[model samples]
Every structure is written in structure tokens, then in C-alpha cells.
Target chain A: MSDYMKRSFLVALWFVFLTFPLMVVKVNTLKNTVEWRWMNMLWVAIGAFVLSLLWRWALERRQLKNKEAESGEDESTRLGFGQRLLVEPKLYKPVLAVLFVATIAFPLLFDIYQTNIMVLALVFVVLGLGLNVTVGLAGLLDLGYVAFFAVGAYTYGILNSFWGIGFWTSLPIGGLMGALFGIALGFPILRLRGDYLAIVTLGFGSIAKIVIENWEEVTNGAKGIAGIPRPGFFGADMSITSATTYTYYLMILMVIFTIFITNRLKDSRIGRAWMALREDEIACVAMGVDMAKTKLGAYAFGAFWAGLVGVIFAARNTYINPNSFTFMESALVLSIVVMGGMGSIVGVIIAALVLILMPEYLRAFSEYRMLMFGAIMVLMMIFRPEGLIANVRRKYRGHKVMTEDVNA
Target chain B: MPEITNKLLEVKGLTMDFGGLRAVDTVSLDVCTGEIVALIGPNGAGKTTFFNCVTGIYKPTRGDVLVHPPAKKSQRINGFKSNRVTTIGMARTFQNIRLFQNMTVLENVMIGRHCRTTTSILGAILRGAKTMRQEQETVNRSYDLLEKVDLFKYADEFAKNLPYGAQRRLEIARAMATDPFLLLLDEPAAGMNPQETRALDELIVRVRDTEKIAILLIEHDMKLVMNISDRIYVMEYGKEIAQGGPMDIRNNPKVIEAYLGEEADA
Candidate 1:
């Protein structure tokens, strides 16, 4: 009787949480009239109740299926052909070939405006990949990653405006500036771990934002620099429409470079050291890994890509501003890394497109996107915490299959 | 200078204090190459504290720890970081095993080879000739060490998946990968059954004989210590109680009193 009462009470709480916003808030019309819509509360409450009941039912069914498997009712341990093919070594080349062709042919099929949207998606992909090095591989939680991006963008923006230097030279210079900032910021907070590290990096973003906003002599204050030059190719006229195509090609090349380099590092000695550092700090020290150096390596390498991406962002957008690199931008990049499996390269690419680009089509419910992200993250923590595409580093089965992220 | 070619470790008046309490007080010890020295004591007798001091986990409040690698002059390694201590040819295992639990058995051993090889970020991404050779050598040497500990069969399995006794052996194999001149084992036979303890006894002797390395171990298992150790040191209340040959220390009355009479006196 108590169990039933508890379940009913929880259902009521869920209904209240799901419907209260709909009940209390009034929408403003174009003519300046505000009215409460009470029916929305009823609809939302019913929806919440149905979803909760379905969730419980599904969980019970899954438990039953697992118990049956453990009892030896199911004997087959072999994977089906389709499953095997996905993991097979011989099929990898062909699958990659298809993806390669599709990436090149994709933007060409769409109009220029559509291609710009795809390029924006690609930019987020690079941002997501850069953050993955620290948060995913080395197990450092970095909340203010946009500071690195901002530093990269502002470096190129200032250099181009003052010295009249073009895109090609600023690319490396911007990356260097970004890496310097990554190392500088990482040094003070290197001793701090996890949530403390997150807070410190959050403070760093605000510091960088304030510095750019107040320093009127160089940064031009809040108004931001203007008339930055774009990229050109071999006597060809680089107009507004063609610049998008040029950047699209450059974006594809850069993503490929990041992927190839990251993959190689993942399997190297330094890669294993970073992972060992994450698994247990004491063990890492006892086994002869320099903690400071390895951690700084994660920071510098991760920031390098973010810096490079910032340069591309400046070149393609043709103008840059402080408003562009906000805390919300950092949150969006982090969401990509989390929604994708941490340390999984392919997962970041797919997640960036789904999370960033797909939101454009849902104009009616745009404000609810952050709310849905919050709910999805909560659900992911409870159900599939390793993420949608969990990257299994080594082909080893431990005592039991672990479901949590690297720490667990 | 002390003869560098014969001795593996030399500690003089090593002391460690935590605020008001002295955990290890002026404990002096030495281990020659190819010799097994056992440190046995009651719980909190500062045996592990002394190990931490020599292996660079904790800096000693006073005195020196010198490592005499083969053919190299004795170097005073006081206050060196733990990782650098491994590079200077000393490796240690914890009382509670500290294997990289998530890594494969092979990768755990490979990490021990960290100080022996060097690679840059450029070398890692390029897969050039020198980097390939370094990686291949790491793999081969790691596998060989795993074979020495008789854990080659479970190389691909995660370290955490190993059985309790196997996990202990895996820890030893990982420490040995640093190519240490002196290996420190903290309670190697703490939770083992008699049969497993016997295997560990033989394994320790084999490690000394085959690898030509000296070992300093802390063990409560009297049989394993007496059967394998060339010499023994006993500690009580942060002070050295006795030191001599294993049989001589075992028969000493003070040693017996420290073991059983402390509670009676209290």
C-alpha cells in the first residue's frame, strides 16, 4: 500500500513540474495584449503522466529480458552479419570512402545560403573536437572554452586591422596566441580539479570578455573592429558569394587534419599517459609520468585547434565582435562534446550537426531548445551516461562492463 | 663515495613527521644488489611511511636517500618528485594495489616503460621510423615482463578484471617495467593464501636472480619473509626494534614482545 502511494505521489510531483510553466506564464501578442492559456496545463500534465508510465513499463520489460538472458534462455553469443560488418576492419576503407565523397559533394548540392548554414555546422564541429581533447581524453572539465576561441578571433581581428596582414599569416599567429592563452590559463588552475577547475575557467571567460570590452585603444571597445580582409586565390576575384565556397573547402580540409592528428595521438605513448593521468593521478605519478607537462600538453593541443577554428571563423564571417563569443557559445560547444561520446571523434561530428544545425528548422519552439537540452542531459546521466557513441579505447573486457564515463 | 657498483640503495637517518607526530624516526637502512631485505612491523609501525620517504612520495623531514645504480656514482635523491624517482631507478607498489584499473594488462605494464623511452607530439602523429621502433620496443618489452610474472595469458584483459592474487602479481610486473635497480614491495603477501604466498616467494627470488635487482619488501607473512629474505628489519612505534639475519631477528625476544606483549602491557 505504501509503495503504491509513493508512486502516485511521485506521479503528481512530475505532473506539477511539467505543467506549472504552462499554467502561469502569459504570452504577449503583437498588439500588446497578454492572456493566460489554461488548457496548456491540462495538455502538458496528461503528456507527462503518459511519458512517466511508459518509462516505468519499459524499464520493467528490460529487466525481465536481462533476467531471461542470464537464466540461459538465450544461447547465442555471436553478432549478426550487420553488426559484424559495422565493426569489421575490411569494411572501414569503403565506408570512409563513401563519407569522403559525400562531404565534398554535400555543399555543392545546396544553394549559397544553405551552404553557409552547413559551414556554421562545420565550425561547431571543430569547436566540439577541440574541447574533446581536455574534457573527454584527459578527463578535465573545461567550462570557459570560448575564451580560447575569443582570444583566437580577437588576435586575428586586431592583427589584420592594424598591420594589414592577410588570412594566410594570421592563421598560424592566431593559433599561437590561442595556445599561449591556453597554457597561461591552465597554469594557475592546474592544481584545481573537476568542479573547481570548471568555475575558474568560467571566471577566465569573463576576464577575457571584460578586457576586450574596456580596452578601447586596441580593441575599439564594444563597437568591435571592422573591414577585415577575406581570403583570395591566384588572381581570381574573391566576391561575397565565392568566399563561402572557398571557406567551405578550407573547413573540410581543417576538420580532416584535426581528425587525423587526433587519432594518431590517441594511440601514442603520450595519449596513454594522458589517459593514465585521468584514471588515477597517484598511479600516474608512481609510473613515471610528469603531471604538469602532460596536463599542459592537453591544454595547448586542445586550444591549438580552437585557435585555428577562430581564425577561420573570422575570415569566413568577414567581421568579428565580442558578442559572438559568449558564455552561451561555450555551453553549446560543451553540449556537443557531452551529447557525443567523450573522446569519440565521429560522435562529435555527428552530434554538432544534430544539436546546432537541426535547431534551425524548429522556429516555433526555438526558446524551448535549452530546456530540452537540460532535460536530455539529465536523462543521459541516468540512462546512457557513456554517451550516444561511446568510444571503447582498448579491446579489453574488465571484470564487469562499466556503464559510467571514464572516472567510473 | 660509497661503492656504486655493489649497493642499490642507501638511506641515512630518514625521518618523516606529520605536524605533531613522528611516523618514521631516523630509520637508517641499506640494500646491496641481488639481496632481498624484508621490513616487518605491526600496523602503523611506519614501515609504509619509510617506503614513501625513499620512493619520493613524501619528502623526509631530515636525512638522505641515495641511489647507486650500476656503474653510476651515488646520487642523493632527496626531495625528488615521485616520477623522477622512478627514472633514478627506484620503483614501489602500494599496500593497496594501485594498478591502472581501466587499462588493459599490457597497457599497464607499458606505462612502466615510460621513463625508458621518449616521444614527442610530432613523433606520435607522424608514425615515422624512430617512433615506430620506440612503440614496437615498448610493446615487446612490456609483453616480456608480463611473461616473467606469468600473466601473459591475460595481457589483453583489463587489469581490474584479474583475480585478487593475479592483480598483485600484475602490480609487481608493472613496477619491474621501470627497470629499477631497487624494487620496493609493500606487503606483497598481505591477503594471499598459503599456496599463492609460496608462488610469491619463488617469484621474488626469481626477480632478484634473473633481473639482478635488489628488493626491499614489507611483509607480515613470516614464512614468506623468513624463507626468502636475506636480512630483516623490524619496526615498532616509529622506531627500529631489531635488525639482523631473518632467523636471528625471528628468535629475538624484543621482536616477540613487540608482536604479542604490547596489548598485555596496556
Candidate 2:
């Protein structure tokens, strides 16, 4: 304990030294003077000291748990809080019921602005889950995932401007377009893996954005399409506020649908094949899983969700420029997947909410938001590398064979 | 002893070259139904390279890999993809134990059932009656295989958590889930203790007698190779040194010199 304290004190001093220039000395160019804030340095030292101690304690606890697991302790004891909740239906059933009611009543209780933000968060939930199929399940690092999102948005935007297609009709069309582009991208990079795949996908994302910007004839170049009509309720006329509420509900339903389908797919044969492909390509193929087919399926499936949500995004905003589908957007969605825990549905939803909604509400810390985000990400990497909830494989319970049967 | 029936796999004049160096040279081998054929050699003898050629991991420079399934016609599978080879009723395990480490033991086996089951993306999303039945069947079949390998208790455990010996058995169980006519074992007993090796010997014979599947193995354990193999093929420096039954192989002077060293004539 004394050694830990000494180490933490040294870390505190190091942080104080690191932040001294930025926090303590501020140059006032207009006044031709310098302001020294020694108090800020002291605060930094105190905060760092406490945080380092906590970090070490958490690391020690994690190591202890791992040792216990290695020694054949009950596996259930090692499950995270979220996993424990999920495992016990008695605990989760009521929690889920309350959550279902709260979501259904959310738009009615909250104002239009809040509902709008909720819609945005739900869109990201879908996007994170979609990318999870490729990156998490199939182990395909796709740095250009936003390209598919752009394709879906552009699909609806172009169709609406040219032929005046409605939201209902273009939804599936957008998803299909996204899947088509996914397959197109997947075909050329079938042999690439790891960092190579990431670089290629990053290029694909940049290429997509550039094409959208340059193609003036169809996309209107930088001048994005506007006035894309909201989804209709049997052609019922509704105000903007009501339309926003309608979108919120639609997104809720979409999130539910995505969760249901992805959950089912994670346990299916195709899903197992994708995971097997991710684990070891050679073994997967040796087990008779078609490599090309499984990989293309992951790409197409992941992109399909991105496309579906892209349409919703355009319709909800009623306008989209090339700026909306930038590389930062792709990185943001990827971060959500990473921080939420890859291949975990519940984790993604929670992470999407926290990430998307927190920034909106914490406008006071706007300037420091990115800095805090980077710090948290670094901490997460050091501690919980598996994200909030690590993915757990489905288990099967088979009837025990009788002792007589074995004898016979 | 069961008669060695029709040939299940026949590799003729298999030769593989990497750049200028020859890895496998004109190594012809065959396995008949209800037989356990062992390919024995010292390190760097290209036994693994030969397995890779036959399994389609490496397209041999000049060879013919022919397979005769139980009711299917004979087909040449040279240059085919590894997955295609597996789907055509030939499955192989890796020398280093390539079970899906992160997935459950049952899931590892279920992945092997990929070729036999047909469920499209739409089928998975919709999950109709047919899809559910197939999934249940896969689970049941995978569980049965785990039981056969005496790993049913660890069905839900991650593949990486299994002990060294059980992991080898799991590989065999996973390969069997592919329903192959011929199973290729690459150094299955490389790291096993004598008791574990004895169990593997029984497992191989049981798989042959009950499932009617032929096995081709590359092993370095002389006791295991001699005890279990119906016939043994010896290779030295990528060349076939000798081929005969276990008794004949035990007495062969060439195999002894290749394994140990040249005798000093006194």
C-alpha cells in the first residue's frame, strides 16, 4: 500500500509537470502580459493522484478476478453486472418492462428537441450494430463504413429529387443500394485483412465523399438535397412537431427490429460461420464454411442497416450535405461500437445513448469534450479493453445420457 | 480386422514447389475405407506440406488428388479451395490445433456443419420453421459429437479453455461434424501423454469401425504410429523412404536409419 501511494504520488507529479504549461501559464497577447495560475496546477496534481490510485486498484481487482477464473471458480461470478442482469430473467424482466414503458412514453413526456436528439441517438444505435456485424463478428476492420451511410442517404436524396420517391418506398431501395455498394467494395478486397483492409476501407470512405461532392449533376454537389418529406402515416397530414415524434417512434421500432434480427442472426449457422471466419480463416474453410460467401454476407448485411438508417437520417433532417457523411462520422460510429463492446447488442445501445446524448446535454463542457473523450477512451483501453460488456456466446443445455445407456 | 475396402482418397505423384525449393516431391499416398494410414517422418520431412497439398491449402505443382465418396463419383480436387475440399467429403485438422478459441466448443463443431446445412441470410433473419429445425439439428449433432469425444461436459466452455488433450479430441469431433469420408489428422498426438495417446488410438479406431470413415494421420510418436496405423508410410527429406504394415515398418532398416542414424559398420 505504501509503495502504491508513492507510485501514485510520482504519477501525480508527472501529470502536474505535463499540464503546467497549458493549465498554469496563459499568454495574454493583447495585454502583452502572462497570467500564472498555480491553483490550476495544484488541482491537476490532486486529481491525477486520486485517479492513478483508483486505476491501480481497478487493475489489481481485475487481475485477482482473472486468477480466480483460472483456478476454476464459478464462471458466473466473473460475469459483468450487465451480463448478470441478462442471465437472471427475474431481475431483467421487470427492468425491461419499465424500460419498454419509458421508451414508449418518452416522446410524449419530453419536448420536441429532446425527441429529435433521441432519434439521432437511435440512428447511431442501428449504425453501431450494423458495423458490429462486419467488425465485431467477422473481424473485418472497415474504416469506410460511413460510405454506405452516404450511399443510403444519397440513394433516397437522388430518388426523391428526381422521381419524388416517398420515405416508405425508398427505405428498402436505400438498404439495397447500400448492400450493392458493400458487395462492390467486398469483391475487390476479399484477400486483404487487418490493417490493409482498414486502409483500403478508409480510402473507400474518402472516395465516396469526394464523389458525392464532385457529382454535381445528380447530387447537386455541395448543395445537399433538402425538403425530403417525413414518413407518412396513411397519408395523414401532421405538423413538424408531430413529424419529429413520428420519427422518434419509427426509430424506436427500427432499433427493436435491428436488435431482434441481430440477436437471432448471432446464434444462426451463418452467424457462427462469420465468427469462425473471424477466429481463424484457415480453420473456418477447413470446416467447410465458404469464405467468399460468408465475408460478402457480413459486408452486405452490415451495410444494409447503415443504408436503412441513412434514409431515416435524411428524412428526419430534411436536408443532407456531403459534410454530414464525413470520415469523422464513420469514426464516431466505430467508436460507439468499440466502446459499447463489439458483438454485444445491449452494450451498443447503451453506449450510443451515452455518447450521443451526453455531448448534447453537456454543452457547458463543450470545448473540453473532445479532450475528455480522448482521455476516457485511453482509460478504457488501459482497463476495460473489452468495452462495457464483452460478448457472450449462446449456450445449449442437452439432456444427460443415463448411466445405463453408457453401459449398454 | 476389417478389410480395407474401396479407396477413399488417392494422391498420385504429388509434388509441391515453393519458389526454387521443393517442399513435397512425388509423394504418392492413398487411404482405403475403414483404414488408419500413418505418415511418419522426422522434422522438415514435408509431411505437413504433403497434407497441405492434399487438403488444397497449397495447390501442388504436379499431382492428382482424387476422392471417391461412398455413393458419389470419383472427382479430381486438385487446385480446389480448402472449403470446397471439405464440402466434397474430406476434412482436415491443423498441426497446431485450430479450434475457434473464442467460440464455445459446440459452436466450433456447429461451424463444421456449415456445408451440410443450407440457410440463407433471409432465412436467418426471418428464422422460419425450417431454419429453426436445421439449427436444432446442428446443435444436437454437435452435442453428440462432443459426447463421442468425451467432451460433452465442456460443450458450453470456450475452446481455448479446454486442456491440451481435450482440445485435440475436440478438433477430431469438429472434423467429424463435417461428415467427411476421410479425416486427415496432422500430428494429432504431437503433445499428448501416453494415456492421452492411448485414448486417441481408441477414438480413431472407434470412429473408423462405427462411422465407417477412413483416417490419414501424420504423427511423430513411434509408439502411437506403430500401435494404431494399419499401414505406415515413411518419408525422409521430402521423399518416400518406405511403405508397409506396422510389423514390416518396425523391422525396416531404412526407416531406422532415417529416424535414428546410419549404423557404423564394425
lDDT: worst 10-residue window of model 1 chain B: B1-10
What are the candidates' C-alpha RMSDs?
5.4, 2.4
Query: lDDT of each structure?
Result: 0.83, 0.91
TM-score of each: 0.90, 0.96
Please report the candidate that would top TM-score against the real structure: 2
TM-score of chain A of each: 0.85, 0.95
**Which whole-number lDDT from 0 to 100 does residue B80 have in model 2?**
92
lDDT tens per residue, model 2, A324-357: 9999889888888888888988888888898899
lDDT of 1 by residue, A1-408 (tens): 456445745785677776676674676777686676767766765666667766776667767756875685322333334334446779767888898898888767877887787788898899999999888888878888988888888888899889887788898988888888989988998788978998998898888888888999898879987877766576477767778887888898989888999889987888888878878777788888888888888888888888988888887787887888888888899988998878878778888988877777676889998888788777766555666666655543222222323556
Task: Give each prediction's DockQ, rounded to 2 decimals.
Answer: 0.48, 0.74
Candidate 1 local lDDT, B195-265, one digit each (tens)? 99999999999999999889999999998999999999999998998999987997788898899885534
TM-score of the first chain of model 2: 0.95
